[model samples]
Target: MLYRDGLTREGIVVDVIIVGAGPVGLSLALGLARAGKSVVVLEKDPGLHTTSRAPIIWPRTQEILADLGVMDRFESASIILKQFTMWNADSNHKLISLPISELKDQTHFPQILILPQHKTEALLYEALKAYPSVQVHFAHEVTGLSQDSESVRVRYATNGTSESEMVASYVVGCDGAHSAIRAALGLELDGITYPLMAALADVKLPYNDPNWVFPRLSVKDVPVVAVQIELGEWRLILPFTQDESITMDERVRLSVKNLFHQADYSLIWQSEFKLHQRISPQFALGRVALAGDAAHLNSPVGGQGMNSGIQDGALLCTALVKAIDTRNPALLQPNAEMRHAKINFGVNQFTNILTRVVMLSKGRYMPWVLRILNLVLKIPSLRQKFLMKLTMLGD
Candidate 1:
């Protein structure tokens, strides 16, 4: 479909050009294309089937997918999550629970959906494939960008050989952690990186349970949380499993072979992820805007990573559509500022809450502290309120 009929670069063209084909970028591309904007998506990876980054999709993210007209496609591929179990490592005491049912009536998709992030991206890519004006170029990387008063020039290279160009009225950076667009803009990101590198491994559970369950452990060895998924698969995120924790290098393999006793299933993929809490000082730099991980990143606690990023994409797309229609950048400016404020506040609150929960094993008086914590969870009203926030039902 190359327009090689002596057609040369003439006028300022293209409604928008997006960099990155991850979930955030793909979702934004679909949203903009549906709004009648021509979009070009540049992805460095030529194909999919690489990593299983985030496995749990929160309830709120389900709502955003529903609005995009492809909720059923995703729902068919994942399982529903409802219950959680927390157990003491040394003691037999355990807490098992489910999210409040009161939220079922509040939204179209009322339950948590558990699916791999790779699958999520595949579904969105499939939907976007039907759009005539939307083009996804694989192995294409943005090399340089220059902005003038009227338009932005994007230079890209394919497979590090062939070169091409595109002129976009506006550009969106969803390129992920090391975004070229963000770096070119000279944005400063300031935050703290925790020392403990979290280990995530997907394994099939030996036991069978019909319901969704999350196991929280306060064992003498290390703190752990187990999340159940469909098809006998489960995700384990725990501190070092041994009393004398091994180095970060051997944690994943050793934990799977000995600590977790989950060597039956294929190891699949493993990583030592740093829990980062950071956000861009500013989300929008002139006509270039940032969303998803490009804008902020936080701990995967409470399954807030992708949900928050999707919310940012939805809001940014809606704002961009409005701005394009009115031919005014001001309309999109507020979108970046307002969403950045909300995301900053939310990330801080979420990080603080997760830090406290995971650090519950720190206090010297372990047994006595556990008793008090159980007492608070025993209160009907108190438990209900806390569960709402923990399940992301609360504002």
Candidate 2:
């Protein structure tokens, strides 16, 4: 029962204090509350964002969401994507339509789900109502944190003015890349930011294709991704050069025209991003832990960042409860190790290579890569192995 206005803050310690009320944080809070742990969520924002930041929910993520018992709402509201087509702009032909059916045996959700990140956050917020043990405080920015063997102390502003204090048996930072908690812990982010910049736009257009997610790569230029978020609204993720100086709106308009061959479109919401593939040296630094972009970052090319963050929350939920219940802090170590290893050698590395590979459409070896991809799609065995990597079910 979270009211939008104000949260009741008694000076009492809770089981877990989660930073950031985005999907990852909220997902962790939900699982903790369902397990009967007292959970408090601290969010800097006033409410759920109006923009669509991350829109694609891969099959594995859908399975996690389904386990939370809220997939029906998302399935009813979003467009279920069955195919991903990579196009060869140089040859003016599609290289391959990815085989999602091959994942049918791996997961019950064998398809990708598309919905704005805000809507997903809202649903997670609403679902938290069923658990009375959870309290979500909006517009509360954490300023400082400290822990000593037993409980962690968190200091934050109630609404950006008055200072408030609370304590928790454990705390996890689900904040983004610029995490205050990560900074307070003095953890170093050990990775690199990619050279390419990306722009995402939510717009209304006459074009409609809900069955497929398309990314067109030019042997002479960078690639472009087009996805229909809903029946009338499309989310276009277009990359720009590092030195490009065009207005974001103009970029959105030009991308719509270039990709869909349609000039009549209205840009509603948009955001610009400098892509990065980075990971922290450690996820759990003592009683404080980092999740989501706070712990790791990957290219948006594979749509793995948010999905991985949600997976982090899901994995952390169980570990946190167990560690708190058993009074064994060492139980938390394995989760941090697993998260770091799976991403560093797995998603982070793969997406780092993928972000570079896509941008190198004009590179010398891109055509040969595309040729090999075509060959892979033709054979079921090879295609299934490829789909395992693409859908992340293999992880």
lDDT of 1 by residue, 1-395 (tens): 22222323355557788899988999999999888888888887787545667777766677778778788998899876554445443454564444445456655555667788898999999999888888888899997687765567888899989888888777888888878888888885667665555677666656544433444343333344555555666566764333334554344444344334444545555666667778888888777888888888877766787777787898999988887777677676788889888887775577656655655544223444546656777777776666556555566
TM-score for each prediction?
Answer: 0.86, 0.90
Output the TM-score of candidate 1.
Answer: 0.86
- Clash count, predicted structure 2: 0
Candidate 1: give the clashing pairs.
84-214, 85-214, 85-215, 86-216, 89-219
Clash number by candidate, in order? 5, 0
Worst 10 residues of 2 by lDDT: 1-10
Best by TM-score: 2
